[model samples]
Target: MKISRIVLASVLMVPGVVLAGENARDHFRDEARAATGELASELMQALQAAMQEGGPPEAIAVCRDRAPAIKTRLSLERGWRVSRVGTRVRNPLLGMPDAWERRGLAEFQARHADGEAYADMEKVEQVVEDGQRFNRYLRPIPLQGQCLACHGDRDQMSADIRGILDDRYPHDQAHGYQAGELRGAFTIKAPVD
Candidate 1:
């Protein structure tokens, strides 16, 4: 009788365990999305202000300096690793994507190619590295009209802006992007508790 009772309880708990896991994933997804949105909004607003105050060339300093500082602050505050990465990166400091991020970027590109709206594109997963569990999330960063001032076709860039980019990032590969194209992604990873 006791054995049968134990078996019944185990069976009953199975569904609960599965549901809990799903709930946890959902919670992490929500947290990641909120954090990503906040960071992106902050960065975009700063960049826009810089462009208005100065111009596209001056905005390059924001990307080169301010963006990383924001990432660092957010990572420290939220206890998550946060960053922006691109397929073709301008800054060598933030260019290389890790294995997981590489996979996420490829998936984003594939989904975009399949006609998925960039704004609606996101990737979330549970990743285990060295026996540690992490919730990884990435959202596409679509190019906007303002971004074109700097990231547009070479011919479209003024010589001054082009020279600034060339001098700052001689090996830059982030160019020739059009509005509505996938510029890159904002990636975040939080440890699973």
Candidate 2:
């Protein structure tokens, strides 16, 4: 039966993954990338849908509301994370994860935003667990004329829009970012062990 074949295939794959020859870190990293891609794609769709349906306010609200769900699912499904660094807000796992803690996001912000240097694109990998690896993919979040309505200077941003950003993320560092300056990263990670 198809079910049996699928189960057999799944069982067969587990050993190879746990096998010593194959690097667990690389396996986890690859898995994490795939997972992150799927999650990010879904979230992007949700954001776009909110924009079309609820407008900008809805778009922002949807993202704010869904972040926790995303984090929880990532932890449960992959035993990993979907998180942001450089956030003044506290994350319980910020320093407690058995194999995670990378400043890739913080580094990007520090160099690009504070240090006044920006890269059009960047990808860096770090070992979070002995065999697991995490990658941070970054690109600039530029400001377009259209975006000025929500994210530009105070004079340009309407009070409602500013309030939205303020309400959801009181310690937001996402502001003051431009189209070509690195906003942050799309981090993909998995345990090496």
Candidate 3:
């Protein structure tokens, strides 16, 4: 009877453990995402203003100049990334996608679907390659519309966009994307001091 009672208790607690873990992950992800959204909004506005100028040349200059400032404003000043997606280049991060996941992502985009945030519940569990613990959160960036052109389809890309991408991100692998697709995760890692 005791053995059965203990077993039942463990079984009952299993769901609670899973639920708690999910809640913790959600809390952490939400905090990081909320912070990132504020910064992204500012960057978007800046990029829009720059795009208003004469041509791509003018816009590039504006974005380039402001890039450093934005970085400074947010302490992601040192470690952060901005990318676009559909060119022929392949992304290094995409390298980690499981075969089935890669196919699922592709299908999701082809259908113009953007999974709900946490649909996949991605998180930075650890940085085994290097060294990290309890000190970081990984946040994924969803591809927004502005990110579609070069990141969506090479053949479908406009000459101007391709030109801009070529000129700016020559080795870019941020292409072949659709709105709301998972672009990459912000690997937030720090020393476990």
Candidate 4:
């Protein structure tokens, strides 16, 4: 009778534990979405302004310079590691994914191929690495019409834009993207209490 009672008590507590876990997951997911949205909004506005000021070539500076600064500011402000990583990188140093991130990107591609809409796609997990717990999040970034100016087919790109890209990103492999294709992801890592 004692054994049965103990077992029943344990079973009853399971839902509470599970509910707590689910709540934590939901909180982390909400935080990740808000942070990612903020970064996207700021970057898009800057890019639009840059494009208006001097076309795609001048807009390159927004990505090359301003984006990193904004990301750094966000990271510092939010106490999280937030950044973007590309599936095909122009600057490998800045855009290469770690092992876990590579798996996430592959999963994203598989989901996309299976007809999942990019706008609705995201991955979130509680991961433990090197004894530290983190809430990791990834959201797909689809190439838009404006993105085609810089990331579309090299052959279709203007000579001036190509010249600037060649000069700036000599090892570029981030081109050839069509509108609505997955360009990369916004990734976040936040500590979990």
- lDDT: which candidate is best? 4
lDDT scores for all predictions?
Answer: 0.88, 0.53, 0.54, 0.92
Ranking under lDDT, best-scoring first? 4, 1, 3, 2
Say which prediction, candidate 1 or candidate 4, comes out ahead on TM-score.
1
Write model 3 residue lDDT over 1-193, tens digit each, in one string. 9999999999999999999878876765665565556556776787677666554455555445664465445555434332222213343332344333344445444443543553344344423433434434444456677656446777787788778877766567767777766665333333333
Report the C-alpha lDDT of model 2 over 1-193, residue by residue, as the tens digit: 9999999999999998778445744555566556656666676788778878977788766556775577568768866655433222223333122222235545555666555654443343554444545543332233344444454455566677778777755555445544454333445443433
Residue 26 deviation, candidate 4, in Å?
0.7
TM-score of each predicted structure versus truth: 0.92, 0.58, 0.51, 0.90
- Which regions in candidate 3 have their CA more than 4 angstroms from the true location? 1-31, 54-69, 76-115, 118-134
Per-residue lDDT tens digits for candidate 4, residues 35-113, read 9999999999999999999988789999999989988998999999999999899999889888888898898889999
Off by over 4 Å in 2: 1-22, 86-103, 106-151, 188-192
Clashing pairs in 1: none
Model number with the top TM-score: 1
Error of 3 at 39 (Å): 2.8
Q: What TM value does model 2 have? A: 0.58
Error of 3 at 158 (Å): 3.2
Q: After superposition, how far is residue 66 of candidate 1 from its true place, in Å?
A: 1.4
Between prediction 1 and prediction 2, the one with superior TM-score is 1
Q: What is candidate 1's lDDT per residue for 3-114, written digit by digit as tens? A: 9999999999999999999999898889888888988999999998999998887798888888899889989999999888987788867856788888888888888899
